[model samples]
Target: MAHLSSRRRHSRSPLKAFAAVAVVCAVAAGGAYAAGVGPFDRGSDAPAPAAADQARAFLADWSGGHYDRAAARTTNPSRARDVLRSFTAGLDIGKPRLTAAAAERTAGDRVRVAFTAKMPVTGLGTWVYKSHVPLQEQANGSWKVDWSLGLVHPHLSEKEKFRLERQDTAVPQVEDRNGKALTGKAYPSLQPLLAQFTDGGGRPRGSILLVDRVTGETKRTETTFGRQAGKGGEAGDAPVKTTLDAAWQSAADRALESGADGRNASLVALRVDNGEILAMANTPATGFNRAVSGTYAPGSTWKIVTSSALLLKNAVTPDTVVDCPKHLIVGKEFHNVETSEFRGATFQKDFTESCNTAFISLRGKLGGSELGDVARTYFGVGQEWHIGIPSYDGSVPRPADETEKAASMIGQGRIQANPLIMASVTATAASGRFHQPTIVLGSKDGTSTTPLPAAVVGRLRTMMRATVTGGTAHVLADLPGEIGAKTGTAEVAEGEENNGWLVAQRGNVAVACVVEQGVTGGGSAGPILHNLLSSVPGDPS
Candidate 1:
């Protein structure tokens, strides 16, 4: 009998809807993002016979993700329904459409067939939304569909459910670069605190799920039951090697607990090269992994996208100067910075200072759709990311008027982003290309690469570096090593400070921190970063 875990449950809600949004967001953002060839246009000329054969080969290569291989692919006559359910549910499939159809016959009188079917919910728009699947010829010379397409299921079997004991659970592990175990029992003393996680009403928020970044495995053992327990709760044997430093997580926890002033603070760090999240923290409320989940106004971080728009069009240069005097009136609206000193400044200066007026003045240089495209492509706003924890989709502010563009340039208007996305923008610049960022490393499906231009990344990196060295983030200059960062402060209701953000990268570690309703990002977030960096094993080197 196939052992099923007690926690196994099913939901009818569409699972692939999220993936569709992510795919559409990625494609929309990469706007005309030269495919290096062409869009997977289903309109290509009739596919050759070899193409059909190739499709069959492709089907055989996919490994199952959401189902137990032993159970899913079993030829056992007794478990046909179980296998069928496991395969179909694992597909996590929503509505699908046929994009292309073709067939061919190979040697030995076997028929081979290839067709592209799209999961409309994965967000490729109707145009590019199709997926290519290949079918092979059975012994009777009839084509049979491969089972890999069934990996889209919204629910998994009892064995595939996410749990510590489940053999199929494959989340990643977290450890320091020095080979020290930061997770598991060594320092899982916080599990008990996490188990007690709750809302103001004394209701359970949810179980704390520790994710392994390297393997994309989820270790979902129950959180520890008490504080100061002699031994840590079962932290689980399945370890995930993360890019985050253990000491940094500890420091970040203390900093958030002490300095948040009753509000919440979420911080995240990533490696530039591969989008590996280093350190992340959501304090005051331990269960909320706000780095991936919290959504708030981007403030100046949106400038990163606006800058890409300008560079992509070659309409402005780093040295381009303009007057940022107080505010610039655009079509009966006004744009200004928190400070009034930028009446006259250049693109480089405005960028370093994060001047709303200077950036807004350049709105006429690019259109709203163009700005959205760049924002979607380069910074990943409005995109759905596969970070281990849940994240929110940022609003790119489809401007209705030129003045709205001005507002967007200042990171206001309709713009909002979670800390997780901002960290991705910074890491893209640091990495010299745009790569998908994830909290859970080595995800089961892995990451997809987009060729964001090197020159575009370089230009943005230079601007961001100035912020840390001499502009808004200058306080970070005192840190042990060279750091690149930007700060954003937004105004919300009832005089609350709203959101304060600092996205930074030092050496291999890239980080983003958000303090909800903190007066200034530079003031509180800087020290948090300093302490986090200092606590890491290789600080100041």
Candidate 2:
């Protein structure tokens, strides 16, 4: 292994070899002249109190991270400063303690000073090593070190570096709201989420490495956090506490599996008042965490957000007359699911039916950015949300044209959301206030929204109630509480089946679910939600 290092650093190619030699010589190594000594006037012609004092001063500066001052005491100040800086930064080792040992004045005017360096490698004990510094009296009557990279480390050659790498990594522990252990086996829907934690935080310990700079090959393990795992493996990183309710999660897990009709589906339930995620479940249970991360065209369930913007602007009322035509076109043709049309329908009726043409007809009522601003300001869409883990905050891109704007008004044309976002939307609409959804405890809330006008919120809630009572989302009407909801059937690419979506609020629990290829939000997603929501006792608040 000693053969790996050399007095003269070599490169893989001749040109680089020449470059390496030039770099090494720039550090004043030429003064050593292979014999570790140089020709100079004897001490009889020089007046030096102690050459060893200069060595101790340089060591003092280097130990205190004063590389510039220390380099000034070296023969080649510029090159010594660069190598010294690189040596400290490259290793990321914390402050070191340097002590000057015995100093020997050779038979000439030169003196050799030996020193011990104690470096504290992170996660490991201190590492001590001994090295010698050659000092020569400059023509200006000052002692300067014949500085070289080798002075930084005895075997340090050109293009060599040090780094600290973990030997054993951290293990993530996910806990329920009350701090009880929650494993993937207990909640199968959390398998994908657990995989993220596991991949990031593995075992618990580490190592520092000496490696080749150009070709990142490890030369040796300089030090380690521990030879065997110690107390580090006990707790790993702090336990990640979630807002999930075990009973509710169990119900959600069951309902999604049983009612998804064996198709891909996801569901999320949140507290309307506080925005704590109560339950999140996905069908198949072991693959993607679609409930929080999957992006889908929200279909008509997005009407909750659109309605808020319009109501805030006083553009329409629940009883406002509107015409729902078979198809409406701006840049492209737009129609309700199955091209359903209702002439002379009330705004509430259009909402209950999830009328695409009806909403598209009102695109001129607001500015291009108004809808997106309303979503972000009032619903936390497109805002940074530290939900205790990685999450995709919903994005509402500014529409490029009237067609895109109209499509966005109806939750299509590049609008994307997941069950977590839609569930939060429903919770906000139901409670007339926005509380950023949080699964993990102590997560940050989204930017505050202006209070939703009570009259407008009343109307929105009325419309959602009507949806469950006598409209498309009537599938959930028979549930044992005042369940208000809106359904959506979002179109996919030309040939794919539309995704079904529904968001419902019963008591203080706001729930949202999506079913792929389910055709209509009311028919496919509603029943599943009914089963899940019904299973849990209604929130008293």
Candidate 3:
């Protein structure tokens, strides 16, 4: 590319070519005449110490009206004559008066010289400009402009050098009670979301809703990317603070990590006093939300919903006795599970062990739609709703025959529920009345409670307690609080494989855990609940 001086070549149109030549000729004639006058006539003027020094002196003399004097000092007289030629080549100076000048020597065998040039005219102000001349000493010991001023430097210090680096920012932290980071240390799978927070330039924000047993509130706190955004606002840019006890949340996270052989697990914990989720988590190894979303036969857990219907209609009491034989003949088919029979057990006892036969018999006596109404109106089923996260609308089969009614009675046939909804149902038994589950803290401004009789909750609690103590959920017998629980293992269509679920509550904390295609709810799912409860504080009383 051409340097700055070459840019002037475009400005010098063909029309102005002769005028420039006339100016050069006039200046040359004057300079030549002065050279003849011998401006510097010192006979003993020896050669300068260095070629660079000679170039500097030449520049100074030329700017002081001593053109011939400067030419004489050059080590090479021929090269010095050329310097004078180029200087006058662009000027119309008729014995031009010199102005000011400065010179410096660089590391290389090159000299930098600067000068101010001025032309005096009557009407125009003094037109002043600065010039940087780069001079290269030739083998003949004289100098010539290496290129142009724009190519080199006018000021000796005007030089620089420029480069680019990648630094990593801190990942967002999930902490425990002792201020320890749970996600990074124990749950590495969560690292991606933390990394996303940093990589996304601190715009990440979300909210976590947790349970409050004391006043029936689902506490909500916003989460943000950085410290400032974590404060929360209308833009929702704030660090989320959840009702989740970080320690309990850690335990839940840890327990879900069990069965490392890629079996998916999901868990949800709530406060029984008012339905507030303490911890809701899922192992998305397969990107499936089985906890609050898996809709399947709730199996034996539906027995509670059925028992609720029987109690509400006065069709059965906690003390009402029934026989649970290994199989109940519904039409021509047989219906049963591991211990389908409870011999002669009360309604509460039959419920504790999850006897399908006893409930199947109860359904025939009560009729199907009666159970369906309780399931739909009291429990959430076949409904679109919000309960923190999206959920699968639990269902109750509208049975067309005795066989379907028998199956529906035992949480089979067309009935379905995600673990989250079941937890809500279990919490209702613990609390006496049902309260809508919330993921945020808000007053019930105009909302009212559904008045379920205290008698219903009292009996349901007894049945759940019996399950934990002497029945199928005996696995939770020694849990750290007054534990009430129920277990379920439902057979999936086309296979003997079943989905296991265990839901329980201790004082204020209620929990539901699910293991897909597992042995039984009392096996895999119960242990997960136990591990999670073991991490909670103060025995939940």
Return the TM-score for candidate 1, rounded to 2 decimals: 0.58
- Over 397-480, each residue of candidate 3 has an lDDT whose tens digit, in order, gives 356566667767777654556667788778877886665664333312222335457888788888889888888899888866
The lDDT per prediction is 0.51, 0.70, 0.54
The number of residue pairs in model 2 that clash at the backbone is 5
Q: What is the Cα-based TM-score of model 3? A: 0.56
RMSD of 1: 15.4
Candidate 1 lDDT over 81-191, as tens digits, reads 355444333333222222233454444433334334332121101212224343444565443344332322222233334222221111223445444565434433233
Stretches of model 2 off by over 4 angstroms after superposition:
1-173, 195-239
Cand. 2 Cα-lDDT:
0.70
Clash count list over all predictions: 37, 5, 11
| Per-candidate TM-score against the hidden true structure | 0.58, 0.63, 0.56
Q: Write the per-residue lDDT of candidate 2 for residues 1-541, one digit (tens) a residue.
A: 0000011221010011111001010011101111112233445644244576677668756754567888998989999888887776556544455656556776466877776776644323355688877888777778888887778778777777777675534446777666677777887787656533332222124576788988889999866644345543443357767787877788888888889999888899988988888888888775446677666778788888888888888899988988998777676566666657899998899898888778878888989879879988878876766555445566575665776778788887546678889998888788778888877777656466766778877988999999889898888878888889989877654444667898999988999998987877877898898889778866722
Q: Give Cα distance to truth, residue 426, candidate 3, Å.
A: 0.8
